[model samples]
Target: MTVPLLAITAWSGTGKTTLLQQVIPELNALGVRCGLIKHTHHEMEVDTPGKDSYLLRKAGADQVIVASDRRWALMCETPQQPLSLAELAARMDSSVLDLVLVEGFKGEPVPKIVLWRRGVKGGVEDLLDEHVIAVASDEPLQTGLPALDMRQPAQVAAFIARWRAAYR
Candidate 1:
């Protein structure tokens, strides 16, 4: 019952997020319950200042949870450690998901598609990794692996859905 984890990874300005923005709907159209995990290196604030959750967290609370009728968000301060992709993936409720689109963690060993284009920084590492499950690119690629259309999300979504089904 493991949720399939896939990634759309490339260097900055390579349209990783943009592509997923399109792909999410495509996944939805195909009836896939998708969960997304985004990796960021910069320090960020998910809780707001002056909010009770923020105030409590600021006063040395290790974790804070906030909820409304529609949704809830949890904020935890990890001063001692940073979570890896697997660690974060473990936090996902796999019972509610058919797929998890991991937006980064390019260095992690996992099944993924290496989104690439010329003039971007990802080409070299992609060539070195056999674990790269596919290539989604604008231009034609020489690799015999499945070459997908980065512009057409449907084609990419179909590929992913088939890959997801095959693994089950």
Candidate 2:
């Protein structure tokens, strides 16, 4: 079965990563097995330059996977194509994960929780579409969506757990 996916979207500097850092652990404590896929506009290289995996990948390997006893990562070179949120989520082991929390791809069709801060310059309303399920903010606003406290990650995690339960 396809694991449920949710996006936490916000403009740069809106603390999307910070919120997830707290929420993921809370979700884990709630017995929710979580997977995450983050999207970044900058060029990314996960392997070290002098490492064997890096050298092999740079020398023409399209896909390189480095595995250890406890962890593994697959670094695929997709220079011309960018995978959508669904495509990236498909690469995860759905049987082990209850849901996948996304850190970007606000334009994707997946359900999203839009985050905003009081002093942030961007307009949060621009991100509130039918795909947005809720709004997490430092200060409460007039958006009719369910309001979540950005300062309290446990509350956000609880919301996610409830959503995941209903999604299945």
Candidate 3:
């Protein structure tokens, strides 16, 4: 079965990641195995230089898998073609994940929870689109859509849990 996908989308400094940090634990407590895919615009490196895995990757290896007793990671070089949301989500093992939460990719067609605050770059309406399934804000908002209090991660997690249930 295809795992349910949801996005926590917002502008920079809107606390999207912070909210997820809290909500994920609440989800775990509720027995939802969540897999997360975070999108970043900046250049990022997860491996340290001079390390075997890093050296192998830098030495023209297109893909490298580093495994240990605890966990494993696969690093693939995709400089030529940027990965799409579907591609990234497909990389996740759906058998173990009940839901996949995307941290960004607001422009994508996936359903998302739009976040807003009293003083931010733009209003919640600016982010509204057909893909938006709900709106979470620090202040009260009457947008005809499901409104969630950003301060309470439990409430958000409960909503997500219900959403996941329906997806199944």
Best model number under lDDT: 3
lDDT of 1 by residue, 15-62 (tens): 889999999999899999899999887889988899888999999999
What lDDT is reached at residue 10 by model 1? 79
> In angstroms, how far off is 17's CA in candidate 2?
0.4
What's the residue-level lDDT of 81 in candidate 1?
Answer: 89
Runs off by more than 4 Å, candidate 3: none
Which candidate number has the best TM-score?
Answer: 3
Assess the local accuracy of residue 61 in candidate 3 as a C-alpha lDDT between 0 and 100: 95
lDDT of 2 by residue, 94-167 (tens): 98999999998889999999999866777988888899999999987889999999999999999999999999
What's the TM-score of each model vs. the native?
Answer: 0.94, 0.97, 0.98
Model 1: runs farther than 4 Å from truth? 122-128
TM-score of 1: 0.94
Candidate 3 lDDT over residue span 136-163, tens digit each: 9988898989999999999999999998
Q: Scored by Cα lDDT, where does model 3 land?
A: 0.94
